[model samples]
Target: MSDLASPPLRRIQRIRHELHRRDLEVTRVERLSPHFVAITLHGDSLANFRSDSFDDHVKVFFDDTPGEPARRDYTPRSFNVQRLELTLEFALHGSGAASDWARQAAVGQRLVVAGPRGSMVIPVDYDWHLLIGDATALPAVHRRLEELPPEARVIALLQVDDAADRRLFPEQMQVQWVETTAELQAAVAALTLPEGEGFAWAAGEASAMAAVRPLLVAKGLTKEALKVAAYWKAGAEAFHETLEA
Candidate 1:
């Protein structure tokens, strides 16, 4: 077994070594869904945006206007260097800074975005794959689903505010949703995994992920097979770190 069962610590090291890894550039933008927008970001400087693995997210900085406190960490939904085009998916919650910015961002508008910073590069040859997330994490999850090998068997748990939040994905992924509000840990714990030697991924709320760790462990999945990140916290305005056990 590898000394580091997961790549998170290594990824953090990569971020520390190079926080401003990619230069920020805003190209074009479009609304993808009622709640999601696909922003086409461009940067001749982004020519070196090297990321071949899935779920690679970046720290995106958005300011209401220039010289203000820029706040946001966004993941590119899809990008291609050959075309010098990168896309970001935004969730319109009428809440966070990023959400509000994305919901109202216009073309010719500029914002600061950064990083692949490095990601959890799971081996492509793993068994079954499981993805769990809410609206905030959909972009990261959707990007991975489309990028994974065509034959991958995936079981995904989606938590949304209501039925309207339910959406579609490109690949053959079985998605189950739990209509929920605040408490998410129990809902996530109730998710059924797909058959096979599966690898699990969960992101979004900290408590939910905290709840997931033990359940996954109980199901006989190794710590390596699971990569859970708490992207935000309840009632917190900024990015909050995950509370580890």
Candidate 2:
């Protein structure tokens, strides 16, 4: 046998939280872009809410649908424990229960949000970071960007419906906005992995993310240093899955 040993993988902590269902009222609403809406919810129930990861998702319940209540997973964009306020950004895709509710969301509207369940806390000390995804991934991408230190090196490849959907991120980070998945794939394929250890994170439509995962691996990212998820799937409701090698 060869005497060489593999390098140690970076440790990613998994944290579980006590599940809580919070009934909150919309305190504010803002049109973030032509395709995004920001809803701020406030209630005493959120006093102990915890989301340790930028990519953590919570279930939003809607009772307006006939028969069974409709629920969808949404990223907890931001939260303030002291104020008992939480903000969620909804991607307006023209349909779906959550989208419809967010489009018509106004002050005083009530909403029930459930657990993030758990969090995968990725360390920030990596030599570099890669963020890839589409419009649906905006909230998580924004959160990660804001959470990273000013000096941390990051490169984000985001696909959006239009130029109008683009949002500003830190100037120090390289942000590439693409209009199609093909372009996103091209961008990923063309990228040169930076020196030293790094982490790659991606989330978006099912098939698109499925396609992007292998490209990152081919670029030399190990399984332990990557996370690719399907935030939604076309024609499927509340679809979310993590693609594993």
Candidate 3:
């Protein structure tokens, strides 16, 4: 476990400090929606793989012919310990190496992925939790829901291109869906949060989420209780493990 003061976003970094490199075989592929695809990976190496944080990201590498491999960061949606299965979801909105690969991914294909390295495990002690992001962040949001206690109260505000992209969660969770980035920002700005100590997590377009950070802080969410990040930026091709503001 480690801690780092990452400027605006003070991070409670918990990293394994070790990397697991594996050649995984694709076992299943499904299109959950027109804009989202889910891929399941299975391999012996997945045994004992630890993904303790809902927001943990693994580095995925793809074949690039004779050159260096193409790499992208993805959240591990679910991991079945008994079956040694790991699932990943991809958003197919942009034209890029990762997006193109996701569009054509199929069973029997091999993929190489490395470390979640470390996880920032958020304690489920808050009176309520708030999740905000675009379609790309649903996997993490869903993971958090699944991991939280049944009595946990959650509020999720998501932005997606279509209503069909909306995700289902525990009945205790209140979900609001919006169609555009601007709508997402407006909704957060005007949010009437539940009472008590609350935590807010936001991930999406860098610029948009950057604008949202201040509002959350001003809205009474302590600096220690807010986790805001830019999942992706417009016109960017490469992916860093952690988003920087």
Candidate 4:
């Protein structure tokens, strides 16, 4: 008998950043959809800012609250070193300090943002990619799609309240837009993973992500091949966690 070939190793690199608390001013705001707002912030502090991962999160501070500032995690949608600007997308789910602030965010308004702290850089050489989540994951998913080569194979399962919320991607990319978390889970369970080494990434409501994590593993994905995160939780404030098997 001949020895079997080992699967290609997928290495995820982690890099730490020098934490800086930046006082940034809102330079622009665009309503991407009924429930999503894109805000571009600019400041001198961002001159050396680096976010090497699509899913890197920064701490956004809201001082509107009477007590200590309310802090929340937000994904860096995009950044331009030359312009010293960083773009962040806020998902407005009716309520929450961040949501409220984004709902009325205006140019010239100052905000304090701190550490992405570190980045976990996932390689893009995988045979296929699976992205699953709700509107909250849009920034990461969208950024990833943009970063990937046009030839990359990707299937994105996104849950959005309205069709207008969906963003355009490469025509070759398969995007399944669902309206509910239940649909999102069903879509994942029914997914037929492509043959070859693949990576799965998911984020959204905590409970929903908890339910979807095992399905991916059951579909022949090892713990090392997938990353699932709880971007937010129902009835809980400032919640974020990465689920591990």
Assess candidate 4 and give its TM-score to the true structure: 0.95
lDDT accuracy of residue 46 in candidate 1: 72
Per-candidate TM-score against the hidden true structure? 0.82, 0.95, 0.90, 0.95
Tens digits of lDDT, candidate 4, 54-164: 979999999865788999999999999999999999988778789999999999999999989999998998888889999899999999988898899998999997888
lDDT of 3: 0.82
How many angstroms is residue 178 displaced in model 4 relative to the true structure, after the best TM-score fit? 0.8
Cα lDDT for residue 42, model 4? Answer: 98
Q: What TM-score, to 2 decimals, does candidate 3 have?
A: 0.90
* Worst lDDT 10-window in candidate 3: 1-10
Number of backbone-clashing residue pairs for each candidate, in the order shown:
0, 0, 1, 0
Query: Mind giving the per-residue lDDT tens digits that candidate 1 earns over 100-170?
Result: 77777777777666776666567655556778787878887877877778888777787888566577875
The best-first sequence of candidates by lDDT reads 4, 2, 3, 1
Q: Flag the better candidate by lDDT, 2 or 3.
A: 2
Displacement of residue 168 (Cα, Å) in model 2 is 0.7
Model 3 per-residue lDDT tens digits across residues 1-245: 11222223334556674788988999999999888999999999998688989989898988776688888889999999999999999988868777899899999999998978888878776677889998888988988998889998888999988888787677777888999989998998888777666678888877778888877776766667778877777777553423333
- How many steric clashes does model 1 contain? 0
Question: How displaced is residue 79 in candidate 2, in Å?
Answer: 0.4
* C-alpha root-mean-square deviation, each candidate: 4.9, 3.3, 5.1, 3.1
